[model samples]
Target: MIEKTRGIFLHAVKYSETSLIASIYTEHYGRQSFIINGVHGKNSTVRAAVFQPLYLLDLEIYYKAGREIHRIKNARITYPYSTIPFDIRKSTQVLFLAEVLYKCLREEETNIELFDFLYHSLTLLDLTEAGISNFHIWFLFKLTRFLGFSPSREDAERCNFFDLQTARFVSHEPLHSQFTDKHLTVLFTRLFTIDSSSIENLDYTQHERRLVLEKLLEFYHIHLGNLGEFKSLEVLKEVLK
Candidate 1:
């Protein structure tokens, strides 16, 4: 049966001379893989260009439970980005975030709230001009809420240390090394209150930004053991710098 849905293009690899296997996260079905046949052909309906990282798409798909892959009957870019592909800073961040989402978002069920959050966030990324440098840091922190481990802020005002393993603030430093020191904790906790509307006002020096990102990734790694090193990390850091 053909079903209509909105999707976010995550990653893809060439499966044949003229075909590609693409992973897309959909509004109704979560993450899914689709094979686009003859996408390299001149008359292909679904152009390969639409599969770019984090591109928002409208899709008509043949979905079946227990199948490893689904067929895209039709696909179109829902919102063509005006700036991300053209700007190196924005492009790098999109690539990095796409890679992270590819690894972290594994649920095979509908999450309307999560889907809306991503769709709007990417749209914002393409539109926003200020605070571009700190976008990824803010995104990573916000993602934790959907992943079920958003850090606890009940003690944020009174605590000086943030225990990554526990996902909360500690009055004293944690015994293990998976914790942020007082100074970094202050920077890390500030992300808890920051929203997309206020992201433009977020100002972080390069050093502070890098440290906070490292801590956020570390926190993710501690919770999601399968999320190893990111290949796009160095590139994103270089681009942002």
Candidate 2:
């Protein structure tokens, strides 16, 4: 049966000379892969272009009770971005974050809170000004809450360290440390009161932001299994530099 739902295009692959396969996180079905056919034809090629990173889409998709990959019946853009495609910095950040979501999200079960968080976050990226360089850092931290691994800031004044491997705030550095005091301080400060509303202006330098993000990724790798290095890390670092 055909089911209609909203989805966010996460990534796409060139399946053949005339077709493509896309991975989308749907509002109802969670993560799904779909094959979009006849996309290479000139007129329709533009239609297929809507399946880009962070594109919001309304879709009529064929669903099965237990099958993995589904077929898309119809799809169109829900909202075309105003500047994400044109701004080089925004484009780079979108590409990198898209890859991170592609790697980190792997659920076939629908989650309303997670879906809402990501949809809002992506829109914020498109609408925000240039100084929002530290989005990647906040994105990772916010995601940890949904993943059931958010660190407790119960005693921020006394918790001088963060035990990355154990995913908790510590009074002192552990024997096997993944982050230094400076790194922990930055993260702790952010964790206490950070949100999109209060983060419009950036006080931190680009270099400082990148360093914090890299350290956070290392912390994630120490905990999350099978997380290889983010492929776009070097490109993102270069762009920031």
Go through the candidates in order and give each one's C-alpha lDDT: 0.92, 0.78
Clashing pairs in 2: none
Q: Write candidate 2's Cα lDDT for 98-212 as tens digits.
A: 8888877788889888888988888888898755676667777788887767766766656777777776667777897575475546554564587887665445577678666
> Clashing residue pairs in candidate 1, if any?
none
User: Each model's TM-score?
Assistant: 0.98, 0.92
Task: Compare the candidates by lDDT and give the number of the best one.
Answer: 1
> On residues 1-241, what C-alpha lDDT tens digit does candidate 1 reach at each position?
8999999999999999999999999999999999999899998888898999999999999999889999888899999999999999999999999999999999999999999999999999999999988999999898899999989888998999999999989999778998999899889878877899989767889899999999899888889885877999999988888
